[model samples]
Target: MDTKTVTDHLYYPVSAQKMDRGEGVYLYDSGGNRYLDCASATFNLSLGYSHPAVIAAMKDQLDRVVHLTSSYQSDPINGLVQRLVETSPANLTRVHPKVSGGSSANEGAVKMAQHATGKTEVITLFRSHVGQTMMMASMSGNAFRREPFPLLYPGSMQVPDPYCFRCFYGQSKETCGLMCVDRIDDFIEYASSGRVAAVMIEPISGNGGNIVPPDGYMQKLRAFCDEQDIALIFDEIQTGIGRTGHMFAAQHFDVEPDAITTAKGLGGSGAQVAAILTNERLSGLPAHHHSFTYGSNLLAAAAANVTLDIVRQPEFLANVRHTGDYILERLRDMQLRYPAIGDVRGVGLMIGFEMCEPDGKPAVKLTNHLASAAMEHGLILRTSRYGYGNVLKIRPPLILTMTQAEEICDKLENLFMAELAR
Candidate 1:
């Protein structure tokens, strides 16, 4: 009731404008102003806000039962496990749904890899935002994330990501000979504790400038992991559940990882749920080692079941691809008109564009400004990593129609015209 007092007591700052409700891709505020949500409400609304199917399923499940301990085998959990195993890569036959969120799912995968390999270290790509949990924050790419904590998780290291736009090795994709994968040997040799458990990665870097790996990168990485006997884990939390047109990015890239961690978009209309899908080798970890209280809630499982059914539809995924391509093409055209847009990269509906100075340096301030100004154009845009990076992400809901996609581009055009005019 006391809005000012509540706002003052909150740990993190929030916008002055309060949101009332959401539908599909649009969110309405208290004043009834509707704005297109390009960030998909933290990139978790794969089916958009207040999705009918998800709501109906949850409502139905609510009548039957809402809470049951994970010890009991409920229909919702059973269906969710079956659906996940069926949709994930063929190698991922086992599904572990007793994880609370993306962070827990990812940590469980690492624990499985460690238990399987008897190793203690983890290798993640530079700039990757794995999670905010203590362990994940320690393993993630950016230094600023871990700087605040004194006693950080040990035995984790970061290697150069396959960001072709500004290759860390200073070689172009043509003549680079995949130096990024090859050089991991050096990092493992000198930088790690020698006993590396897994190589975790996001197929397309989420919150890391939307950096799509160069061609053959995933395959080469797979081979490298195999050669090293290191478990390969795909952190598909942001890219999974139809965000990438494919059921999983592993399917899109055609390289099966030893394990895949999924969350974020799996709940469709924002139910809190997450799971870790693993092959037989990485499935030996006991449930007690990594289970959470809310891991297998019946209500969340019901929401996930309907979400999976909708996203698994061939037509639904096809529309995501088509719409993504259309938006990418429109952004490329804008890139030519505005020199500030240094690059545009994406797969399916997960897209981002770099804001750069005339000299090709990261335009961090400009990117932040655009995100803040986007609301003026009736659009809600979010910058990568809360403005620590120079990329503006345009990842709308997967259910976006062609007309809505056009509207997004048009609004972006007007935003650029007003802000970036020569």
Candidate 2:
């Protein structure tokens, strides 16, 4: 690709190299150089690249048919919905599919919440990122992503997230009485004016540096929302489908959300599909208010069914928990050895390590430099824009083995030592 072509069209510059193939947990470039796919293409390839089951399902779907525009019903679509409902919380029995990504799923959830309650306002946590679409962008707390789209949407409010690392309230996780949850309730009381439809949250903050709240945070939010008659929406787009060693992150807290949104790993390793799962009370709303043409396409549905089957297995979930624990322990050791590592936090496979300068201020530049350096060492990692962009996100596939986790942790330690010497 030409420089002008690469630079002018895309928001980010496209690297010249092209991916040739992928298998298991590795990807190869056109030159046949293989790299360990720790990033998992933004942490979506849960079953890893080119799984036989997912591929077979898609091929079988192709042999039957591809699109059936929601005007008609297809077996795969029905089967996928049944599988989703069976795997999700008992109350979340209704499903609305979408052909877009996580952004669209968030948009759909917001619309449903509003339609069900006739409320105009919604609440989200500061530093939380829902999606990049117009409505989702408005709900997102990322200033950089929302700067150019100030009037993107209306009736979205932000509150303090339960980020114990750099607590806005100046309290440690041990001493803090979940003032963050109380703050959320206060915000709802003052901001809602009885016009709020939903309070959307990441059960465990995903894009906001994998910030896991204090124990009972989610349960408290659920109880508060119930008392206030506001819907609790869980943006599980990043934390669902066994990424957090559970079918849904809300399961970890044993709290049920009125609505939950999912995408990414839902389709395994192929097709783009997302869904908004709601309870019967929420689903009783008029159907004419929401519909999508390719929402329940047969091909995508088939892939999703297969993906859910694999992720819902007892042995598979056990593997996820085991691997996740190993990774977290290794990260904790790194934090002890490197002063640059400020905090290591997260649950299951979704983890983050905050970076800081010797003087104790967040070091955004150093974090980005480390990510670039890791890429050079054939390990891909993500940098969070939240927490002043000082957190390194490590969300590899749930299928990653213990040996692979050791390799990643060892490389990270070596990289930190080398950078400190420099």
TM-score against truth, every candidate: 0.99, 0.95
Structure candidate 2, residue pairs in collision = none
Candidate 1 — which residues are off by over 4 angstroms?
Answer: none
Model 2's TM-score against the true structure? 0.95
How do the residues 113-209 of candidate 2 rate in per-residue lDDT, one tens digit apiece? 8888888789998888999878888888877878886477889889998888889999987888888888776776677665788999988777777
The residue-by-residue lDDT of candidate 1 on 1-422, one tens digit each, is: 59999999999999999999999999999999999999999999999999999999999999999989999999999999999999999989999999989999999999999999999899998898898899999999888898889999998999999988899989999999999999999999988878998999999999888999888999999999999999999999999999999999999999999999999999998999999999999978877899899999999999999999999999999999999999999999999999999999999999999999999999999999999999999999989876899999988999999999999999999999999994
Candidate 2 ranges beyond 4 A from true positions: 1-11, 386-388
lDDT against the true structure, each candidate: 0.94, 0.83
- The 10 consecutive residues of candidate 2 with the worst lDDT sum are 284-293
